[model samples]
Target chain A: MKPIGLKDLFVIFLKAGLAFGGGLGILAVLEEEFVTKRQALTREEFLTDYALGRIVPSGTMSALAADFGARFGGFPGSVIALTAMVLPAFTLSVSLSAAYVYLAGTPVLALLPLTILPAALAFIVAAALRLGRDITIPSVEALLAAAAFIGSLVFRISPALLLVGGGIVSMVILAFTERAENPA
Target chain B: MNPLQVALTIMVLNILTFGNGPALVPLLEERFVTMEGILTVDQLLYAFAIARVMPGPANAYVASVGFFLNGLLGAALAMVAIQLPAYLMLPLLRLHERFSDVAGVKRFTRGLTATSVGLIFASTVSIGRNAITSLTAAIVFVLALVMAYLLKWNPLLSLALAALAGLALHAAAPSL
Candidate 1:
């Protein structure tokens, strides 16, 4: 690809942002537009960055931009990628937030929680399942998920503790798995 | 009611957690819903649902909370606080390749990934308990899930269907 400007970068992520709601299956679009068409990043690089993004706070989209943006255009590139990533969605969120605040106390809007809440949970479940299918491959991770669930829901363990302890356990497991595989 | 506090809360939460915001919804409930009574569980979940339907990072929901507490300025401040840190950290992320093989980094990263999965599942349970009550609601949830998982419909489309189902159900059985 020729030298890509921040304007083009912004447009690319703006299109991705538009897909976020119902168009959440945006990887294909991204693959076609950025990877194949624009030659922005190779497929392998995008996939690796996406996986790395999962372990970060912002999740896949922003992570992709942050990771590759630095490589592609240095610090300025990363800034543009991150800003473009949020612009469209942030605008939508602002409007939705305003409407939510305005309609908060009305009788009719009260029904929104009763109705939309379930849908929200359902969406979370769906998104989780999609991601979980990837995480559960190691069976041990599934156990961790189960353990975490019990600890949080039944035992009421502190979220911070569970996360920290779980991370420690996983680290131990990774070390053992590595040693077993390589015998080093 | 304090915009600064809300901004600070978002920044702290984002800084502390290693994954999506949904995974840590319980902490949010403790702080905003129960302790402060800033918003009821229903309102909070509803706002979260709105955030879901919108396109963006999960942290954008902080703006929704800010909007509830103050207004547009609150939303802007909250968003800036949560996101500024991530941007600042980008440089570290870029430089981390030098330490990629360090045992401590490997352990921290892998461990956090597993823990994040568990935390996310836990949040699902917590949110589900609050969201599901009536049979109608349960049905809507399952339908939405099927729509998302099976049909692979757009989230906006599935959510639109769900909103319609909610309205219809409400019209049919007001008590439910």
Candidate 2:
């Protein structure tokens, strides 16, 4: 397939942004369009970008877009892809926030919180379980997770500190293990 | 909230957030809900709901929270702050060999991922305190969790059913 231009990228992401469902839903659409349908990016390349996006900072969805954009269209492409992907949702969220400020207490929309809160709780819990299920018990990663949980929830420690501490511990362990393996 | 302060806080939050927007929830709740009390838990949950209902990333909820705190500028700053890392990753893409080859990056990512997962788990309790108010709401929460986690149904689908259940419960017991 030929290289995809900026306009095409924008249009594709815009369509994705407007599509129903959230981040994962948009990812499926992207995979279909770029990997399966257009064959612009091979499945391997697409998956690598997706993985790298998750590894990097920011939300995975936006990072995926930026990574793909940079791959296809350089810096301009990255900006355009992210902007298009988020434009629709940003507008709606902002508009709703504005409306909610004045109208939240009103009877017709009163159930908004009652309904959304529990559902949101469900969403948060499910996300936690889904992510944690992959972690092996008694591993360093698990230890880090347990430590972070206790520190943040029980001690109210700063999350930044926990994150830095976890990363450093992981890096040190990895360094030591690698050195032990290659003592030539 | 001051716009500059909001932007700074979001940038820090973004750095700690690994994988997804939801990972940032615990940090956000601590900053906005628990520490400063800028917004109530219900308001933050509503922002999350709006982000879910709308298309794109769930992280866009930051914009709603920003708007509630300040206005359009706040929303814009939050959006930019949250997305800043993606753009920052662009230049790093050029260093693919060195970047991915570095054991440090992989180890750090693993650690961060673990930390994020733990925080996400912690957030369930923190947010649940405010979210799970009555028995009916708890039932909705359980059902939604089942649909999303066990049945592997779409989150949107679970939320839709939850909304319906909420409406039904409200009608039955207005006092609740």
Q: Which of the numbered candidates is closest to the native, going by highest TM-score?
A: 2
DockQ of 1: 0.52
- Which 10-residue window of candidate 1 chain B scores lowest in summed lDDT? B85-94
The whole-model lDDT of each prediction reads 0.69, 0.82
Using lDDT, give the best candidate's number.
Answer: 2
Q: Weakest 10 consecutive residues, lDDT, candidate 2 chain A?
A: A108-117
Once model 2 is optimally superposed onto the true structure by TM-score, how far is the C-alpha of residue A115 displaced, in angstroms? 1.9
lDDT of 1 by residue, B1-176 (tens): 58998888866766556436565465566568756888776766766777676766665676777777778888778777766655544555565556554575556665665666666667777766776878778878888888877898877788889878988987898787
- Which segments of candidate 1 are over 4 A away from where they belong? A21-35, A38-56, A67-77, A135-138, B19-21, B88-97, B100-110
User: What would the per-residue lDDT of candidate 2 be over residues B69-155, giving only the tens digit for each residue?
Assistant: 889999998888888787656655667746567678888877887988887787778788777878778878888889888998867
